[model samples]
Target chain A: MDWNCTLTEERLSDYLEGSLLPGEAAAFSAHASGCVQCTQLVAQVKMLVSRMQQAPPVEEPRHLAGRILDATLGPREREHSGSGMFAWLPSIWQPRFAMGLVTVAASILIIFHASATAGGKTALNPVNMFRAANRQVHLAYAHGAKFVNGLRVVYEIQSRLTSQPETMSEPISEPARAPNAEPRPGQPAQPPASEQRQKSQSIPHSGRRHTHGASELAALSIISREDLTNGAIRSIL
Target chain B: MRRHTRRVYNLCYRFTGNAASSEDLSQEVFLRIYRTLPSYRPEQGAFPTWLTSVTRNLLVDHYRRTRRDRLTDSIEDAMPQLEEKHSPARTPDRLAQASELSAQLQRGLARLSPELREAVILRDLQGLDYAEVQKVLQVPEGTVKSRINRGRIELARVLEEMGLRPA
Candidate 1:
């Protein structure tokens, strides 16, 4: 029988353990009997394995099981920090650096929060929003006062026009011009400016003509774009 | 759990050679086992084999994490050669010799690569069968056997260096 060095080394453990097939075992035994090198190799490995097998195991702690159970059930109490974030590190790890880092991080957050609350008002007031509202209020009030005065004059003009509608044909237009002494020889129908003003200011004689003028003026006075510009939203509120 | 606690502890001790690390690793192993209880399928493999795999993985993680702190040593110069001293075959003498041998073996075990060391520890030290080792290692039977043989050879070389040559 021929001994294959590689094959013998590979199957030596199986052979020693009696796990090899009957025929293979017999053949290996025959080869090992003739091959001193393989035989010595087997003996040396066997002795090494025996010494290793006899190697004494270190004793386990009595409290390990209790500690494990307590850890799993309750909050994990530190036991040498076996699986902790710093567990991988040696005892030489500097706690001071870690503490400093945490302190810096916490301080940064606190300072950021303080600054945000304190500075947010001024920081976000990109356009002086409070001043904008104040300016808008002042303008609206000024425009509203002017608008009210203009409305009173409009009402007076409209009331006069409605009362004197029969005289409104070319008569209302004559008061805006200056009084003149010149009179046309063929066109004596137009009144002088002062007389035109006096006549227009008085009420007209026709009832149907006055009613028409009053209805038209009332319709025109209901709303105007100037009302919106003068903060008419205040009325809605 | 009690039956295997010693084994897990000793394996950790052998790997780390530290009492504190063994205790911590033992607690962590049981904790991990409890955490992973739902994932264990009995039909796939035996419980011990599964437990050993978990333990080996944790030790590997420990080794890598602490590699920066671990001291490197020359395997040849690690243990000095000495003249073999013959003592009377007394119980005390045998116990002392066993204790001394135990220390030398541990140092030797530490010097081996993690894979070979694990294979040797699982097969020879822990007394697990090849099949169980294969399951724990997740390697082919051939690989397990080769690793064991290689590990034994290296362990024998280390022991020889420590002046414990077999007649």
Candidate 2:
């Protein structure tokens, strides 16, 4: 192969890229080793190609992407603003803001409904509103107190009923004791057998009466022992 | 979008050697792409190659359109503007050397003819392979290689003339 300066110049990139035929590459290298202009050209071009390949790309303008988008997509909706005193009015359309507005409106509606019902007539007057609010507060307090007293009475009945079994479980003295017994001065005299039987039967009735009185005070109704037990079991479950 | 924009912008900046014009040309290229997006067939080429082709066509049209203006306005006047835009003081410390070399290379690229400049940029700076460059240039592979070869030599000479020895 007749390798020359022209061949070297034409095949310069191929030689640099190592894509030339082995024979051609050998010939090209042989020619360039002896030729001063070819050697210098090869060195310089090789260095230039390497540096260019390694060169960092020029930084584009930061806003070029935004500008292109605006140009392509027609200048995005400008974030919904108005040139008026109520500039923030458009912000109310946001989902979060709208949700908050709905909650506030519902709360106001509830307040008005309660006031109208409590006052016996709907009026926007401040005095009427205040009076209705006061009445509502007093009614709520009364209901709360009533509820607390009912719970207290139910618990008290449950405790007394539970304690009655323990009292009855204690050992009862023998009923066959002598009819006539000597009385000691310091000790209280035992009641007669018939009296003792009457007293024992009267004890549970007295407890029932006490429970009835408490239930009347708390709930304005009578609650039997069985009902109180059922209520307590239901509360526990 | 960001990747495509950077590619287009880099091509424009390399070809035109002006940041403002590159930005405008990049937007224009994307706008053209947007309008003609339907016409783009994936079977024809990869999207990046198509994008590069669109950018190259626009650059060629831009070069032709601004030939008269470029002739009237001194290139020396434009060089300072580019330098001021990419001043070393403004660039971060790590990028200062690369930036300087890039600026110097830009000046050298400006001296080459449009065909040679585009060839060198696509092959070397843009890192397009010969086949891809051929596709983007819409030329035969032989012409792409020849042009890249000549462009590299011419650029080296130009850079040497400018006292910049590539490391």
Candidate 3:
């Protein structure tokens, strides 16, 4: 078959793509090899086609998909301002918030339980609740004060007992008397000379110290009783 | 949906050479697709081919609708917007070169007739084979080949005139 510049130009893509018959391709190549304009045209078109094929697709706008979705699917529910009002509601379901709410509810229940049981019988009236809460608070404060006084008395008695051992190391010319022995009925009411000497030596302020020790022991007993009652109430609850 | 959107958007941008118009056209194409989805038959073609056809038809309509504006307005005014809009986060030297070449190619494509431009875009730029291009264009395979050939030649001459040698 005869080939010319027109045939070469018309079938240029087919020739470049190697889709033309072998004879036709040879003829097209021969014609293009001799023709300067055909060669340049072939080269130019070939390069342009290759460049275009290799060119990356243009980057679309970042929000193009979102816009298309919005247009096709209608506006999203989250985009509405009305729905945004309740957005914070989801946050309330978080573990941290749930735990906090549970703790507060438990504390309120405990307070109500304590107030209701302050008296022998349960009273749900506002005035009774107030009076019960007030009484409970005073009782708690008194129990705390008594416990502290008991600790101080125990520490003072321990120190005095420890000092007594050291004093007992000294030799005694008279026999030792019981510290709490009462005077015999027929005997004189005055204390023995040995007791007087020991009192004078051991206790510089005997009267005041003895009175304070007695009051502290009484407070300690009261605290022990309160603790037992509290334990029983807890076990019942 | 995202994949289809990008394909449609790239087609519109390459055809119109205007970012805003391309964006609007892309949305319009998908909107039409969404409405006519149920009517789409599987026997017609693959989903992408159908999508391309839909996009091409909308683009042709858009072209006719805005013929008067295109005649009166300069394409150069729309060319710089593409460059300004594309500020990639990390542009290596090669990417910058490709970006410049793409812009130049866009200018060249703008000078071609709509038929030739779309033929070249679908076949060469969009990487569709001749058969797919024929399906998208709804034309004979011979006509697709002819148009692609002429379009490439014309574009090459235009790019040469603009002092760009395709490397």
Candidate 4:
């Protein structure tokens, strides 16, 4: 067998383990039949495997298995046994389990604290304090008096649009004249200057109306965003 | 539970050369297995495969945690060929020779890089197939085969140095 490059390590390992696919196995067998290098590698691998198999396992101590089993399966058996016996126990009698739970909780808390300490992140470190303060400042900026003022402006605009519907009507047909001025004899009739000024002021009213769902939502969102914003959330809490 | 525990204990003892540490680690392994039972998915692989992986992981962790406590310390003195009553297939002289050879084999194994050691142990000692080892190692099958071959070559060399031929 001309094994030189044809006998790859993968094929050899697979062949040794009998895990190669049929085609690859057939190919390998064909190569091994004629390939000296491949046959020698196989022989060497076999010798190594035989020696390993012959090596006796280390002695296990008595009751080691029992301990392992106990560790593995003890909890389930305890759960089953305890549940049956402790089912009738009053909530007052639950203190033992509660105490055990508390101890575990305390240990976990200690572990967390110790880990933090080891990482140089003690709970009361100045960095944590600084971060807390910075967070608080951000929250205040997002949901403070300034935000409320903006919401109030929006609410006022909404009220004006809703209460003054006529503010959205079409413009007057004639040009403006001075306040309280009557139309000239030859001139087209026109609104008095005062009415024209009022109309001009109210023209903007229609634009402020919350006609679309998004706009309505915009009105509600002032409060909601404030609630979600860090400052607002902190305030609410 | 007792029978299962015994089987696992024996398995661990076979893997770890030290009896005491193996006993302790075996218990710890089982405890972890029990705690993680809720997350075990048999569909992921065979139960034994998963179990072997778990056991292997525990042993590695134990080795790491107690790096100072190696079998090499008492190996020369302790590598007597004998089997305890439980695993009674072993005869005294063959057992003693096998134990010494096992020690040499373990030393050879210990000398290997952990990755190579893992591949060799999975393939040879635990008798896992290449595909199963690939799954266990989360590596391509080609890489697994190379590691195994390289690992075996190194082991044979080490064995030769220790005056034990591969055969």
Per-residue lDDT over B1-167 for candidate 3, one digit per residue giving the tens place of the 0 to 100 score: 77778789889988987767888999998899899999999898899999999999999999999998766766444554454456343234424544877878887888899999999999888888998999999899999999998988889888887778886
lDDT of 4 at A141: 87
Global local distance difference test of model 1: 0.69
Question: Over the stretch A1-237, how does candidate 4's per-residue lDDT look in tens digits?
Answer: 333434544466567767787877777787776778666666766688777655544545555655565665563333223356685545534788889878999997875564355346554576765566576688878777766776566566556545443333322212222232465688658766787668656665433342343355555555554444545335444
Give the clashing residue pairs of candidate 1, or none: A163-A204, A164-A204
Off by over 4 Å in 2: A77-94, A97-237, B75-98
lDDT of candidate 3 over A4-60, digit per residue (tens): 988988899999899999999999989999999999889988988888888888777
Candidate with best TM-score = 2
lDDT of 1 at B27: 82
All candidates: CA RMSD (Å): 19.9, 10.7, 14.2, 25.6
lDDT of candidate 1 at residue A83, scale 0 to 100 = 56
Q: List where candidate 1 sits over 4 angstroms from the true fold.
A: A4-6, A21-37, A54-56, A75-237, B71-98
Write down the lDDT of every candidate, Cα atoms only.
0.69, 0.81, 0.78, 0.62
Give the 10-residue window scoring lowest on summed lDDT in candidate 1 chain A: A172-181
Q: How many residue pairs clash per model?
A: 2, 0, 0, 5
Q: Worst lDDT window (10 residues) for model 3 chain B?
A: B87-96
Sliding window of 10 residues with minimal summed lDDT for model 4 chain B: B77-86
lDDT of 1 by residue, B61-133 (tens): 9989877655553322343221112222223443354466666677677668888889988998888988999
Worst 10 residues of 2 chain A by lDDT: A171-180
Model 1 in CAPRI terms: which quality? acceptable
lDDT of 4: 0.62
User: What is each candidate's DockQ, to 2 decimals?
Assistant: 0.32, 0.57, 0.45, 0.26
